[model samples]
Target: MTYTVNCSILLTELPLLERPAAAKAAGFDAVEFWWPFESSVPSDSETTAFERAITDAGVQLSGLNFNAGNMPGGDRGLVSWVGREGEFKDNIDVVAGIGERLGCTAFNALYGNRQEEFSPEEQDELAARNLAAAAEGVARIGGTVLLEPVSGAPRYPLLKAQHALDVIARVKAESGAQNIKLLADFYHLAVNGDDVAAVIEKHAKDFGHIQIADNPGRGAPGTGELPLGEWIARSRELGYDGYIGLEYKEPQETAFSWAIREHAAN
Candidate 1:
């Protein structure tokens, strides 16, 4: 049950290229992130620099998200958007290429916010098609495509774990790709009023990756009421030995004390 720091959320005070090293300095040997660059299809130079940063940092890349549009500005995702499918498709190769270079095997594809112009059925259809394509691309590299359920964003659908799992089933059935898996993000599920324990107990076998943040404020463990440590223990008991991504928010310098404690105990 090793842990991976999420550079996109943690160590954000540092420049994007420096976060991986910062994560390593804090005792993490592996890290994950959302799309770090502004553009999904960055230039060759930009791509090379990003790869170099991770290599120089000496940390394994654990997981990455496909472009989710303007994440900070409230665009939950774009893969499922009607006019944005092309962009999502274009970014798949880029994400897969980077993941392959970094030895990353988990890729998350966010189901975009529901557009008023498009009916729910229409959006689901588009999402299925795009996710299928993404699954195919990542499968070529022996990577698993992850479906995550986000919370507190009404416009974005798939706020519940079941919703994301249903979509995973749909993508698998449609594409006949068996590498599709669930990314069980406890923070999002708790925010959406889910019984995190029950969900984990029922669906842990289907999960390929897991992320954590204490709820009520999306803070690090122990800052909130979430029993994150307990849940993690339960997950391990359920036969999940993969990386547990630390996807919380805190001051960069002090963010890893809890993880340090865990490491020491181990």
Candidate 2:
């Protein structure tokens, strides 16, 4: 039941290269992040520099996301989006390469928002195909593909745990690869009004990773109503021993007292 900080959400005031060090300073020995580069296929220099930053920070890289179109903008993901398959595929090798360098095995692949031009069936078909390919590519490095149900975007089809699991099953059956698993994010589940505890009890064994942010504000664990600490303990009771990613928003200079408290309590 160790913890890893998500630099993409925490420590936004610092430069990307410095975030790993910041997390380390905050008592975190591991961290995860979304795609840092704007380009799907960044140059070797950029990739190397990123790897160096993490290595020099002396923290383990726990998880990384495959390229999702424009995160800061409105794009939820790109792999399932029509006409963006090429770009999404182009990022697989890059992500896998970095994952190999960082000793990171968990990789999240976001299912893109629904497109009006494409029917639901078309999107599902495309997602399954692309996810299968992604699963295969990451398998070369002994990496696992993570499917997460995101909140706040209605157009995104995978908003419920069942939907994400269904997609994972489809990809596995279609690709004959078993490296795909679920990324259970409690905040997203609670935000969508699902019984988070019930979902965890049923799918804990299927989870490859877990992330958390409190409901109402998507902030730190203690900032909202979710009993994240209890939920985390429950997850461990159910046999999930993986890192719990702290994927929550925080002020630029806020202290991670909540994490310290949780660690002490555990």
Candidate 3:
């Protein structure tokens, strides 16, 4: 039951140093960044600077996002596994190297949406192949990659957790790799009408990590329709010991920070 920060909110604003400091001020002990390595943070200096931030803030780097279509000329949101297999392998290797160096072993994997013209089944198979290879590369660096499903996003063809589980099952059955697991984001689940608790309990074996944001507006835990307490209670009931990632945008810095602090204090 650790509180962690998802630095997506700082993607455009906030200097990298201020990101961790903000988390610390809010009483969080862990932080995660979405593709921070690819941003202005230099490859050689990023790790050292990031490590200092963590120490200064008394927090840890939870993990890094592999990449997303949000970046210009990025994979366009489907992981580009269908036709860009070589680049996929290369990207995984690069991220894995960074993960090993930064003491971050977990990563978020989403299939960036492909062109609508591609067959859904074809895209699925391509993603499956790419993930299997990515898993192998991640394992070499003592890490694991979690496949996250982005529902309600026009770009995602496989937009459900169950569907991602099916793909993971098939990949495991075919390649015998267990390094790959499910990364469930409550925000997407709420939009797609998935039962967060039930999915977590029923498919606990397939889950490696979790992210959270309120429904509708994608705000803080207490800001929207998500029953944060219920999910936390059920998660604890179901024996989930992994980090609960806070991925959301705050209207103001501490609008809901007090809620998290109170929750932690309690």
lDDT of each: 0.89, 0.90, 0.72
Error of 1 at 61 (Å): 0.4
Q: 104-201 in candidate 2: lDDT tens per residue?
A: 99999999999998899998999999999999999999999999999988788888899899998888788898999999999998998778899889
lDDT of 3 by residue, 1-266 (tens): 67677866632367777778777776677888776655322465775776677668777877777755355454434354466666566677667776776577887777777667778778877777777887888898778878877765566656678877888898898888888888878788768877777787787545688888887788777778788768766776776777888777775455456465767798
- Any idea what lDDT model 3 has? 0.72
lDDT of 1 by residue, 1-266 (tens): 58899999998888999999998888779999898778879999998998898899999999999999899888888768999878899999999999889899899888899999989999999999998999899988899989888987889888888898898888888889888888999999999988899988987877889999997899888789999989888888887889999999999767987776767998
Ranking by lDDT: 2, 1, 3
Local error of candidate 2 at 209, Å?
A: 0.6
Q: Give the TM-score of each candidate.
A: 0.97, 0.97, 0.86
Better of 1 and 3 by lDDT: 1
lDDT of 2: 0.90
* CA RMSD of all predictions: 1.1, 1.2, 2.9
Q: Between which residue pairs do clashes occur in model 3? A: 77-112, 77-113, 78-111, 78-112, 78-113, 79-111, 79-112
